[model samples]
Target chain A: MSVVIEAHNISKRFFLGERNQRAFFEDVSVKTIRGLRRLARRRLAPEQSSSRDFWALKDISFQISQGQTLAIIGENGAGKSTLLKILSRITQPTTGTVKVYGRLASLLEVGTGFHPEFSGRDNIFLNGAMLGLSRKDVRKRFDRIVEFSGLAKFIDVPVKNYSSGMYVRLAFSVAAHLNPEIVILDEVLAVGDTVFQKKCFDRMEEIIDEGHAAILVSHGMAHIRRMCQICLWLKNGRIKMLGPTDEVASCYEKATTHEVVAHYEKQTAEQHGPTHPSAIAGLVQWSVQSKAASAPHSIIVSQAKVTFRFEIELTAMISHGKISVSVADAQGLILFTQQGELGQITRGKFWATLELPFLPLKPGEYIVTCTISEADHPVAFLRATPELTVLKDESLAQSGYHGVLNMPARLSVEQIPQA
Target chain B: MAQTSSAKETRVQSVPEIVTGTNDALPSAKPTYVVDADKILSSHPKDLWAYRELYLLLVKRDFVAVYKQTVLGPLWFFVQPFLASLVFIVVFSQIARLPTTDLPPLVYYMSGIIVWTYFSNSLSQVASTFLSSGTIFRKIYFPRLIVPFSQISMNFLNFIGQLLVLFGVIACYKLSGHRIELSLKILALPLVLADMALLALGLGCIIAAATVKYRDLNIVVGYTLNLWMYGSLVIYPRSAVPAHLQPLLALNPMASFVESFRSCLFDTEHTTVQPAVIATLMTIVIAIIGIWCFAKAEGTFTDSI
Candidate 1:
C-alpha cells in the first residue's frame, strides 16, 4: 500500500516560565521591571535566565498508509490532542517534519469554523471554502449536504436563528461532504445526536473503503477497536506502544487497572492490632491469611483457598459470642458473607479462623470485613478490616474461567465420517 | 517523479490505490505538503490561492450577517453614513467653525464621512480579527490573513452603499446647474481606495497579531482609534492646520488620501502627489511586515491562546 502520510521525529515544546507567563501586552508593560530584576539576578546567578520548557509531544514518529486508520489513545495529558493539532497543521512542531501526499481535511472541533450569523446554505459554502473547496465544489454537493442534515427548510435562514441542533447538523453535513484523501478527526464525532454519530462512523468507513487514510484521536475504546487498524498509545508525551489495535488496547487496559490499583492502595491503611487500647478492647488481632499458607494472600489468584483469621480479647467476661466474615468488592458490594455462632468465651484472648475452600471471586481487589458480637445482643462487637485482591491471570486460573466461578466444562471432539 | 514537495499542486488523479485496474501502475501524480517548524514563518501563497473561495464566502458572511437581526436590514447602510455626516456638520462645521471647502457643508462632510467611516470601520474589524474569530482559529488551520482580508470585503460593500449616497448628493448639485467637473486626479480613485484598504489591512494584521498574545492591546487599540479619528483631516480641511503643523499633519498617511478624495470631489487641487506617493510606499512596507508577524504567530497561537 502507498503511504499517504509520514511523520518523523516530531516534538513540540511550550515555554512556561516567568517571562513566558506574561502574554504580549503584559510582557511589554512589565518589561522594564522584569529587566531590572533580571539584571540583579543575572549578576548573582546567570543560569537562572533560561525559560522552562514543557514538551507536549516528544520525538514522535509514525506512518499512515492508504486505507489505514490510526487510533491515538492516552490518558488526558498524554499529548493526544497536541499530536492531533500538529497533524492538522494548526500548530507547528518544535522539531521534525510531516509529509502528506494527499489532500487533507480536519475536523478537530464540532462546527468550529462556522459563521453563526450566516444562513445554513451560506455557512455550507463558507465552511467548505475554509476546508479548501471551491464555490463550484460546494454547489455540486450542496443538495447532498442539505439532504443529509435534514435542514432543507432552514437552508436560507440565518444559522443564528436556527436551533443549535440544526446548526450542528448543518455544520456536520458540510464537513461530511469533504472528499479529501486524508482525514484528521478529533473527538468531534462526540457531538450532535446518536444518528449523526452513526453517520459519521459510516462516512469514515466509506472514506477508508476508497483507500483514503485517517488519523483519529478518540477516548471511545469501542469505536477505536472497531474503526482503527493500528494504534498509538501515548504515555506522558511519549509513544508507549505503536502496533496493531488489539495489542496496544490490551496493554492500555492493563495499565489503567494498574493505575486504579495504585489509587485504591493509597486509601487503605493497615493498622497493627491495638492502636486504641482503651477505646475498643474487644479484639487484640484480626487478619486474613491464605488457608494453605503456601501462596501469599497479598496476591490471591482467583478460586484459590484462603482463610480469615481473627483474635479477640475479653477484658471483661462475655457469653454467646459470634463471628462473621464479609468479602466486599472494590465498590463495597458484598460478594460473599458468612457467619457462625461461638459459644461462651470467658477468657482474656481467643482466636477464630474461617477458611473457604474456593474464593469463587473475579479478578479484582476486595475489602474483607470481620465482626464479633454476642449472639443474643447485637451491640457488643469488634470489627477488623483486611483488604483482599483476587488475581485471575489466564495462566494463573487453573479452571481458565474469568468471572466469579471457574467451572470446568469437559471438551471432547468426535470426527464425523464424510457422508 | 511527480511528488512535487510543495503544495503548488496539479490536478490529482482521484483513483483508489486498491483498484486492481490496469491504471494501478500509473504514477499517482499528487503533490506532497510537508509541515515543519521552519514552514511556520512562510506564508503559503498557493495554499491561500487554493482556499481563495473561502475568502469570498467569508466576505459574503460578513455582509449578510451585519444587518441580520436588524429590522431595517440593508437600508441601515445608507442611513448610517448620512447620519454620521449630519453629526459632523453639526459638530465640526457649525460649532467648531471648520472650513467646508467651496461645497456645501452637507456634501463636504458627507465626502469625509464616507471615506473615514470605511477606513475606521475596516481597521477596527482588522484589529479584532483574532479575538472575534479565535474560536475558529483554535479549531482549524487556515491562512490567518483570511480573517482580516474578509473584513475589507465586508467594508467594501458598506463603502459602495455610502458612495451611492455621495452620488445622489452630487447629482442634486448637477441638476441645479452648478456645472460640476472632474479632474485628472479623480482617475486615481481606485488607487486611493486600495491604499486605504492596504493601510487598514497591514495595520490590522500587526495589531491582530500583537493583541492575541498581549490581549490588553485590544482596549488600548479601541481607545487609540477613537483618538486617531481627530488626528486625520476627516472633520476639517487640511488648510485649517497652522503652517508650522502642516508637515506634521502630512506625516499621517491618510492625510493625502482624505485630502485627495475631497480634491477629486470639488477640484480643490489640494491633493499633493508627494504625500500620496509616501502613503503608497508606507502601505507596501506595512503590508509585508504585517503579513510576516501575523503568519509567524499563526502556527503556535493555539498554545498561547
Candidate 2:
C-alpha cells in the first residue's frame, strides 16, 4: 500500500505568555528544564517532554495508506485541532514534518472562508477557489452544492442574512463537493440539528467509500468507532496509543477514566494532606467486599452481591450520627444515597449489606463516594471508591441473578365476564 | 567510488523525506516587516497579475454598492461636491471675502473641492480597509494590499463621476463668456490623481494596520481627516494663511496636489511645482513605510483581529 500521509517526529511548541511581557528569559528557563528532563529520562522514559512544553503534539509519527480512514480521538485540549491545522496548512509544525500524497482540503471550522456581503452564489465560487478548486470546477459543482445545502431559493441573497444553520449547511456543502484527494473534517458535523448531523455523517461515509482518505477529529467515540478502521488516542500532547479502532477506543476509555480518577485523587490529596488531619477527621475507612471467592477484580452491579463494610474510627462518641453511601454519576448527581443504622454495630466497626436485585442503571462505569458526618460536618469522605461497573444482565445467570434493585410487591388479577 | 555511492544514497533518501516533511508548512509564508519596499512592490505585480478578476469584481462592487441603497442613488456623487462647493463659495468667498488665486471664487473653490474630495475620501476609507474588511480577509487568503488597492479603484470611479460634473460646470462658465483656459496641461490631471491615490493608500494602509491592534487610531483618523480638510486649502487660498505656516502647509501632499489641479484647470501660475515634487517624494516614502508595516502585521493579524 502506498503511503498517503506521513507525520514523522513532529513537535509543536507554543509560547503562551502575555504579548507585552519579556518572554526571553522565561522561554530560556523552560527550554533548559525541558532539555534536562529529556536527558535524564533517556532510557526509561519515552524521550518526550509531556509537561511544560504545552506540546500540542509531540514526537507524533504516523503513516496512513491510500484510501484509509484514521480517527483522531481524545478529550478536549488533546492537540486534535493543532494536528488538523498543521495538516490543512493553516500553521506550521515547530519541528518535524508531514508529507501528503495529494491535495488536502479541511473544514477545520465551518464557514471559514465565507464573505458576508457576497451573494451565496458568488461566495460558492470564491470559497471554492480559496479551497484550491478552479472557477470552472466550482461552476460544474455549483448546482450540486446549492441543492445539497438546501439554499437554492436564496442562492442570490447575500450571506449576511443567512441563519447560522443555513450558513453552516452552505459552507459544508461547498467543502463536501470539492474533489480533493484527502478530506479532513474537524467536528463540523456537530453543527446543525440531529437529522442534519446524521445526513453529514452519511455523506462523509459516502466520501470515504469513494476511496479518498479522511482524518476525522471528534469527541464522539461512537462516531469514531463506526467510521474509522484505525484510531489514535492522544493524552496531553503525545499519542498514548494507536491501533485498530476497538483496541484504541478501549485504551482511550481506560486512559480517560484513569485520568479522571487521578485528577480526583490529586484534588482530594491536596485538600487533605498528611499535615491537615482536621480536614478529614473523626471517621475511618470504608470498603465494599464481595463474598464470591473468584469474584472479578472489579464487580459489575448487575451480577454481583456486594456488601457495604465500614470501619469507622470515631474520635468521639456521637449520638444519631449516620453514614451516607451515595453512588454518583460522572456529573456528580447522586443516584442513590442510603443513610440508616439498621444493621450497624454501635461502637467501633459497622457493616451494612445491600444486594441489588436488578440493575436499573445503564451499562456504564460510575463512582461511589461515601461520607460519614454528624449533621452538617463531614468526619470522613471517600470519593470515587470501588469504581462500579454495570454489566449486561445475561452474565448473571450462573450467580443466581442478583439484580441492581431489591423490591417486594404483590399482584392480583380478577377477570370479569363480558356481561 | 565508495564515498560517492554513500553520498548518492543519502541524497536519494533525503529528497523524498524533505519533500514529504515540508508539505504541511507551505501556507504560512507571509514575510515580516512593513518598510520592505522591494517585498511590497514585488508582491503587488504578481498579485495584480493573478487576481485580475478579483480586482475587477471589487471595483464593480464598490461602484454599485456605494450608491445602491442611497436615496439619491448615483446622483449623490454630483450632489455632494456641488453642495459643498456652493457652501464654500458662500461661506468663504461671500461671507469671509477671501481672495481667489487669479480665478473666479466658484471655479477656484470648486476645482480644489473636486481634487480634495477624492483625496480626503480615499484617505478616510483606505485607512480603514483592514478594520472594515478584516472579517473577509481573515478567513480567505489574498494579497492584503488588494483591499486598499480596490478602494483606490473604487474612489477613482467616484472621482471620475465628480470630474464629469465639474466639466459640465466648466462648460457653463465658458458659455456664459467667463474667460477660462482649456490648456493641454489638463492632461497632467491623471498623474496628479495617481499621486494623491498612492499617498492616500500608502498612509491609509499604515493607519489601517495600526487601528487593528491599537483601536485608538480609528478615533484619531476620524477627527484628523476633518482637520486635514481645512489645512489643505480646500475652501481658501494658501495666501490667506500666515507666511510662517505656508511652508508647513506646502509639506502636505494633498495641498500640493490640489494646487496643481487648480493650476491645470484655471491656467494659474504653477505655484505647486515645488510642493508637487515634495509631495511625490513623500508619497514614495509613505508607500515604503505603509507596505512595511502592513507586511509585518499581516502574519499576526489573524490572531489580533
Candidate 3:
C-alpha cells in the first residue's frame, strides 16, 4: 500500500511565557513593556529560565499507508492533541514538515471550526469548506449529511440552540460523509449516547473499508482493538511502544493497571470540622487497603480477605458503640454486610479494622459503606463509599463468568447417562 | 510512496525536497509529504481561487448575519452613511465653512463620506481580522487571507448599497436646480474602488499581523485612521489644501483615492491623473508588503493566539 500520510522529525517547542490572549490595549501595552524586559534579561543571562522552552513533541516520525489506521494512545499530557494539531495543520510544527499526499480532513474536536451562530445548513457549507471540500461538494452531499445526522428538522436552526448531542451528531455527520483520502480523528468517538457512539464506530469502520488512511487518538480499547491495525503508545511525548494493536493494547493495559496503586483517605465533608456537641464520637477517616496498608491498587482474589480500616475521632466519651459495614457494587447493589457489635469506646482517636472474607464476587469494582451507632440510636452516621476491585482467578474457566458472582463449581458430562 | 526508508527525524534545516530527490525507487503512483523543521510559505492564491464559492458564502454570512437579527434589517446600512454625511454637512459646511469645489454641500460631503466610509470600513475590518477570526483560526486551517479578504468583500457589498444611495441623492440634487455634470473620469470608478480595497487590505493585513504580538498597534491604528482621514482631505476639496502641503499630503495613497473617487461624481477639476497613478503604484507595493507580513504571521500566530 502507498503511504498517504508521512511525518518526519516533527518537534514542537513552546515558550513558557508566551500567552495566547490579546484584546487590543490590555495585552499589547503589557506585552510591549514585557518584551523590552525580556530583551534586557536575555542580554544579561542569555538563557533566562523565565523564557523557558517546552517541547510538546520531540523528534516524532510516523507514516500511515492507504486503508491503514493507527491508534495513538497516551495519557492526557502525552502530546496526543499536539501531534494531531500539527498533522491537521491547525498549527505549524516548530521544527518539522508534515506533507499530506492527498485531501486531508481532521476531526480534531467535535464542532471544531463550526460557527454556532450559523444555521445548521450554513454551517455544513462553512465546515465542509474548512475541511477542504468545495461548496459544490457540500451541496451534493447536503441531503446525505442531514439524513446521517437525523437532524433534517433542525437543519435550518442555528447550531447554538442545539443540544450538545445534536451538535455532535451534525458535526460527526459532516465528517463522516467527507471523501478525503486521509482523515484524522481525535477522541471524537467518545461522545453522544450509546446509539450515536455506535453510529460513529460504524461510520469509522466504513471509512476505513473505503481505503482511506486514518490516524485516530482515542482511549477506548474496544474501538481501537476493533478498528486499528497498529498502535503507537505515547509516554511523555515519546513513542513508548508501537506495533500490532492487540500487543500494544495489552502492554498499555498492563502498565496502567500496575501503576494505579494509590493511598486515599476517605474524609467526608462533615467529618473534617468539629463534631456535633451531643455526639460522643465521629468517623475521622476510612481506607480500603491491601497488604500492610502500603498500597491500595492490588485486586482481591476469590475467597481472600480484603482490609477495610476506619479511624474515628471521639469528641467526649461513649460508653459502648458498634460499627456497621456494607459493600456495594458501582450500581449500589449491596453484595456484603457486617452487622454491628457492641464494643467499649473512649474519648479521643479510635481505629478499627474489618476484613471482608470469602467475597464471592466476579472480577469487578465494588464500594464499601460504613456507619457507627450506640443503643440502636445513630450518633454519627457515615454513608461514604470507598471503592475496591476484584480480579478473576486464573484457575476458573472463563465460561459463564458474567455478572457479580464467582462461586466454586464442578462440571461433568457422562455418556452413560444417555445410554 | 512505496519506498523502504527508515523513519528518522530529518531536521530539515530548510525545505525537504531532497528527501524525494534521493528516493528514485519510490513508486510514482503514490504521493508523499515530508515535514520539515523550517516554516514554509503556504499562501497559495490558487487555493483561495479554488474555494471561491466558500468566499462568497462567507461574505454572505457577514452581510446577512449582521442584519439577520435587526428589526430594520439592511436599512441600517443606509442609515450609517446618511447620518455621517448629514453630520459632515452640519459641521464642515455650516460651522467651519470649509471651501468647496462649486458643488452642493450635501452632494459634496456625500461623495467624500461615501468614499471614506468604504475605505475606513475595509481597513478596520481587515485590521481586526486576527482578533475576530482568532477562534476560527485556532480550530481550523484555511487560506488565512480569507479572513481579511472576506472583510474587504463584505465592505464592497456595503459600498454597492452606498453607491445606489449616492446615485439617488445625485438624481435628487439634479432636480433641485443644481448643475452636476458627469465627467468621463467616472469610467475609472472601478479602478478607484480597487485602489481603496487594495490600500485597506494592504495596511489592514500589516496591522492585523502586527497586532498579533504587539497589540498596542491596535490603539495606534484607531488613532492613525482618524488622523489619516484628516490627512486625506475627505471633508474639503483638494484646492482647499495649501499648495505647499499638497505635494506632501498627496503621498498618502488614500488622498488620491478619495479625490479621484469624488472627482468621478463631482464635475470638478480632473487633475487627478498624477496622484491617482502614484496612489495605484503605492497600493501595489503596500499590498506586496502586506501579503508578505500576513504570510509570515499566519504560521506562528497559532502559537500566540
TM-score of each: 0.74, 0.66, 0.75
The collision pairs in model 1 are: A24-B213, A25-B214
Off by over 4 Å in 1: A16-52, A152-157, A264-419, B1-31, B41-43, B177-180
Docking class of 2: incorrect
TM-score for candidate 3, residues paired by index: 0.75
Q: What is the C-alpha lDDT profile of model 2 across B1-305, one tens digit per residue?
A: 21222222211111112212213443333322111112221234564456656665666667776766689899988888888888988898899998887677777777777787788778888888777877665444456676678788888888888888888888998899988887777888788888999898888879887776666688898788888888887777777889989889867888888777787666776556877898899999998898788765664454444
**Candidate 3 regions with alpha-carbon error over 4 angstroms:** A18-50, A113-117, A263-419, B1-35
Interface RMSD of each: 11.4, 13.5, 9.4
> What is each model's TM-score for chain A?
0.61, 0.69, 0.60
Model 3 pairs whose backbones collide: A95-B37, A96-B36, A96-B37, A97-B35, A97-B36, A98-B35
lDDT tens digits by residue: candidate 1, B1-305:
11121132212222112211222232365535767876763347877777678788788778877787799999888888789888888898889889876778888888887898889889888988878988887777777787788888789789988888888988898899865565666777888898999999888888888876776777887778777777777778777889989888767888777877777656885647888888789889998888888887787777766
Model 1 misses residue A69 by how many Å? 2.0
Which of the numbered candidates is closest to the native, going by highest DockQ?
A: 1
Interface C-alpha RMSD, model 1: 11.4
lDDT of 2 by residue, A311-335 (tens): 5554455554656777754434467
